[model samples]
Target: MAKEFTSLGLRLHADAPHISYVFIKHHKPKEGEAEVPNALYVAGLPLGLDEVSLEAVFSVFGHVANVVLHPSKRSAAVVYESKEDVSQALQHASSGQVVDFPLPAPEGPVGLKAWVASHRAQRPGNAELQKQLDGWMEAHEAAEAAREAARQAAMAEDGWTVVVRSKGRKRAREVGGMSTVSGGIAPAAAAAARAAADAKQAKQAENFYRFQQRDRRRSELMDLRHKFEEGRKRLAALKAARHFRPN
Candidate 1:
């Protein structure tokens, strides 16, 4: 295993009189320790970030292996199946890349922060970096399991949760809270949805009836014209067949 990052930097500053801000960075990699090439560490994310949105952004390059978002820590870790995918995603959004991609938000014109995952700090010639990296992998797995459990618990007994995906971001914004009685959704939103559906059906039915009426009227008109034409032809035939009679 070759060291992925050669340097590590962590600093805390008092951004405000009573608030402290922490900044983290990775600089160098050690010898023989393979870099954590498949994972990405994201920071300064917007509130209510989710795995699907992250995938929609990064999976364009390749398959996303996994995503672990630390809500408490206000950061997230994204893993990819291939190094190329990681590079592609990073190139699209990394602040340190040659062509940096700033992941802009929809509501505001602000870019999301993103970078490649780095192992824990170690001495210049120590082999302990691998141990730390292995620990990180274990922790990530545990966090992911916990997140999935929480999501399941939040849903109704039917294991179904309905969400409307916004055009801006694919985040599932719940229109209304769950329905306690039916264990589905709120009554008001459901009613609105039902009403909208009914209106659409009514409109379609009206159009269909109008079409049917038009076709029936046209058919009747054609039949009347045909009858008149046939009667005229019969009268002409009778006149021609009869002897020339004086009235």
Candidate 2:
């Protein structure tokens, strides 16, 4: 459950001389909202007469919600819906005259708002409360500082290094067996080395296959040209023979 700070105050009527503080039994009935259909029972009345006696006393106002009783334990609680009903019940139930049984005092003051204001005046304000809070905060901070100091002292006593490890690339290279004087590999130089190797390999493999393809195509063209020239010579000879013959 979440914790909360609610202020509860007690007020006494200045004129009521007989009572100092009303003794609400350490075990008293809890007052619930009026709509709930349950009432508490007063304990230790004679078994058969108990319910009849309570109903007779409480039903005078409105309705008796419920009643609880334990004769051996000698305690009881009665519940009613209306404040008017409860007021009427209390009128008859208190002292030995009605039920001849003891009952607890009413829970809250007769004038609740005035009682609350009186309590607020008597209590501390936010500034004084804050001062107390600040004192606690300072004490907590001092305790934390002491703990940190003790931790550091323990580390020193055990020969631990307090300095943080450096995250710089140059420092990492020096730690990893590389020289720091030259400031590591230059970007341009690394790019040039990779490019030169790629260019040399590309040039060697490219033209060797292209030269073989070109030579094969040239030989096939020459053979086709020779065959076409021979065909032209045979046609010319045929035309000459036909002209020379009787025509």
Candidate 3:
């Protein structure tokens, strides 16, 4: 830790009251991340403020990748395109201040009681979250490999190369927005539904053609019956008169 200094009008944690300033260690790049100094964590944002507008103002300093707001923690994290971008942003800030972020949607230059942290401190439990994600990805890849191997074995003894997934195509989705294998309907159920739909359409087409053919035959029989009725009426009239003429 450097000289015990206090940040003026900045708070790292929301739970701690009465302590307006915090003594944070010098920023070291987060472990396991890329060598590029690409992220900046901002603290002391107001509740309910959106990340989009926060990013919009910070964009003036550098090309921003994403801005994630932690409403529960009352902090936000901004990722830049490159390490140089981070340095440029720090230069834009006032002397001794890490982040010069203005309060989101302020009338004048009057800003919030905010401070920026390293990528690590900006988010709590990020390490554990990353570990879980990595484990999930590994399991997903292993399962896919097993399926491919089984498919190859099923292919009759004729030598055939197993085709792998195409590049750039995503394999599995995470649990947030889309309903994945955990929360979504099973694959077997989906396949059965598709088969049922196909069968119903086929049945409908068969009935439609059958009805059309029946209608044609019925019309032919109706025309013959109508002609017979007319001939019978003519014969009756001729017999009643006791004479028959071409008229």
Q: Quick one: best TM-score, which candidate?
A: 3
User: Backbone clash tally for model 2?
Assistant: 13
Per-residue lDDT of model 3, residues 31-56, tens digit only: 98554357775655544346776676
Please state the error at residue 227 of candidate 3 in Å.
99
User: In angstroms, how far off is 117's CA in candidate 3?
Assistant: 31
Worst 10 residues of 2 by lDDT: 1-10
List RMSD in Å for every model shown: 27.6, 21.0, 23.1
Task: For each candidate in the order shown, give its overall lDDT on alpha carbons.
Answer: 0.55, 0.51, 0.58
The regions of model 2 sitting more than 4 angstroms off are 1-110, 113-123, 161-247
Which candidate, 1 or 3, would have the higher TM-score against the true structure? 3
What TM-score would candidate 2 get against the native?
0.25
Distance from true location, Cα of 6 in model 1, Å: 17
Candidate 2 local lDDT, 1-247, one digit each (tens):
1122111111223333332221111123347634432433333332223444555544555676666555653444556665556554444434323222232333444345646867987877999889999999999999998997687667666765444333332332231232222234566776898899999998776656977768878988999999999999999999998889574
Off by over 4 Å in 3: 1-36, 71-73, 96-247
Tell me how many clashing residue pairs each candidate has.
13, 13, 0
